[model samples]
Target: MANQSELDDHYTRMDKIFRLSLGEKGAYSCARFDGDFSMTTEAAQLKKYQFIEEGCKIKKGTKMLDIGCGWGHFVDYLTKKGVDAHGVVLAKGQADACIKNGLKVKHMDSKLITPETFGKFDAVTAMGSPEHLCSVEQYREGKQEMIYNTYFKQVADLLPIGGRYYCQSMVFGPKMVKFEDIKFGQTDLWKKEFTDEELMDIICEVFPGSWLPYGKEGLINPASKYFKVVSVDSGRLDYIETIHRWTAAFTAFNLQKYLLFASFVPDYLFDKTFRRWMRRFKIQANLHVFTREIFEHYRIVFEKVSD
Candidate 1:
């Protein structure tokens, strides 16, 4: 699983820009456009969150735990809807921002959460977090499935038999390159031409300490020990649109964002690692994988069915 520092390498690096573009409570996950890419980014994100709300049967006064809550947007939304929502975030910048906004968020690992720590939530949601449940090292050591099983078990323990858990994650697609073929950091960033295998490396640099499941089935099978799958759907196309919109937001003219960008100029110019990291964003390797189906997205609702 991605340690706190690894997760922050991505989330915290973009904290200021994300806040400036999406506001203090904006979401960072894929939005649900349902094949209609015309909707504004904000609208689409809210739509996706509402879908999770309905799918989980959340209502006013419903107690919920938002696992890996980024920026506390969904938690804030639930609070506004009268739901008693608490969030657990691993990233320091994210937790600080949430608390600054008076949100009920704890900067702690969700895997450590138990009934004793939080009592029990009426529902649980892990959006875009499970993808980080198994690190590359764990996957290589053949511990991926075990890591996944542990995640499902933790979530299962946090809910009742009928409780719902919503999860959204990315999985490898048919076109995924062989893991061995991925030259994770050998390729020069300035190279104008590259192969899919090399692109996978850039993607790794973009999201280190993380590895994905094979597909929706990879997630479902591990979860089968503790929950029954209630619903599952592909959000690949929606994620493509979401990425496009995000690119627009990040590149759009904003005084705050410009200031943030300016602050990074010194490091970007002198720090090779930081410069490389910043360049990784320009490759849009994530968008590449999704567009080519090298990675698939899934949204699911699982009902607790076992201990």
Candidate 2:
């Protein structure tokens, strides 16, 4: 997958946009939304945190470790609820923000975590981290299962029996097109839609060294040896809604936000590659979901089991 530098550089370029679109908390993951579309992005994000709390059986005084805790929103939520919550992230911008807000967060890779590194925790939650745990290249090299198993074992070692691990991530959906068969700027996937090859390129730029799991089983099977899946839910539609709201947020930008956008004009006008990737990454994610069904989102809770 992506080395630490690649991951850091990728996030450095896009963190500002995420901060603008996701609001003060800087949440960057899918939000929960349904027929009742009245909830704001912040509210929906809190709902997601609530789901994690309930799923992991987190209560007051519970010691919880949040891996890849973007902007520390979940940690903030849990801490306010009287839970002893701590977070770790690889993004510099996110870690700085969380620290500035007086939250307990570390700027480091989650994969480096071990019982020796952080000691045993009562519970662990990886909101959007597992998707980055392995890359497509790693998977092609026959290392996906091994990587996942090792990751699960790390979490297992950090939790006592019956402790929980909550994970939410994007997984390959049904009818997915083969990787090699996917074309650039082609319309075969949809009646009148073109799959921009550049879109994939930009995605690579945006996420650098990350890849998604093939399906829920990709996670469940590997984790089965260490933890038992307690609950699983398809959050695909919720993600679709979350994306639309993000688009609207950027579109409804005000003067202050416009100033923020204007600051990037120099990069847009000069750094052609970065500009194109930045714009396309935002646009293509929504398009791919509707037209290609490239992936599905899932939220799962796994309880540690003694083996």
Candidate 3:
């Protein structure tokens, strides 16, 4: 694990890289990054709107809150369906884009929300945000319960009775590979080249500000306290598919950029090497799926119980 300063620096770099990768368009339009777009349109149609449609059963003219609405995709979807959709995002660029696209999205942190300021909604969704809460408590004895309990308490506060909450995140898989085993090597041919440690180090380096502390057990246990887990769905196949798409897209983009600039062969080689490793990682992710083991992505739907 990195020290506080190191982590801070790493997040700063990540923000820069993310901005570059996304450009002024803060939305991740690539179908692969978001399952709703990557999977077949029919599959996305079934799952993407499943939670909201189910929650709509509780109230008509429903007001929905998207806790970390990225580019207002869900909000747009809801608005079209005649639901009053509002969203909060920490990224200014994303907020701006959402506004420009005629969506009601605000730039705010989840912790800053209040009953008066944000108002209660029929539904709320974190969508992969809660896992970013800082904690090592899950690895300790009694502390684990305290840390996770507090998390659920906060979530419960934001929801009213009969309100629904939805979330998607990467959870601890059944097989916890040591941080060192998943690396692949740099070879011209298609082969796994780096070690798992190297991959984790790169991820840490790239996303320093991220805090992904919750595992499968940690998340479900805490959530069970305040909400009834209606369903838990795995999206590992989506992740594997997404990464492969990213590898291909980045490779193609790099090659095109190099060719346009000055025909830099070295850049092409670097991209090719990265694509090779990414392919291997995709295979490993798929293997986990086949085993019904731990998954990299999971979506949970919950209903708030009466206080």
Best by lDDT: 1
What is every candidate's alpha-carbon RMSD to the true fold? 1.0, 3.1, 6.7
lDDT scores for all predictions?
A: 0.90, 0.77, 0.55
Cα shift from native, residue 185, model 1 (Å)? 1.5
Lowest-lDDT window of 10 residues in candidate 1? 190-199
Native-to-model Cα distance after best TM-score fit, residue 286 in candidate 2, in Å: 4.7
Which candidate wins on TM-score? Answer: 1
For model 3, the run of ten residues with the poorest summed lDDT: 24-33
lDDT of 3 by residue, 1-307 (tens): 1233433342232332333443323323222224454465334433556654674342347877877676676777778778888887665556666787788888766656776766778778766556444433233233555655776676677778767887766665654455335342322234345334444434433333343543656677877878888777666666665545444543444443444435434554678644443444444433333244433667778888844
Per-model TM-score versus the true fold: 0.98, 0.90, 0.66
Better of 1 and 2 by TM-score: 1
lDDT of 2 by residue, 207-297 (tens): 7677677889988988999899999998888887777787777668677677888897898889966665656555555446434566778
Stretches off by above 4 angstroms in model 1 are none
Off by over 4 Å in 3: 1-46, 55-60, 135-147, 177-192, 246-295
Question: In candidate 2, what residue range of length 10 has the lowest lDDT sum?
Answer: 184-193
Q: lDDT per residue, candidate 1, 218-266, as tens digits?
A: 9999999999988999999999989988898889999878988998999
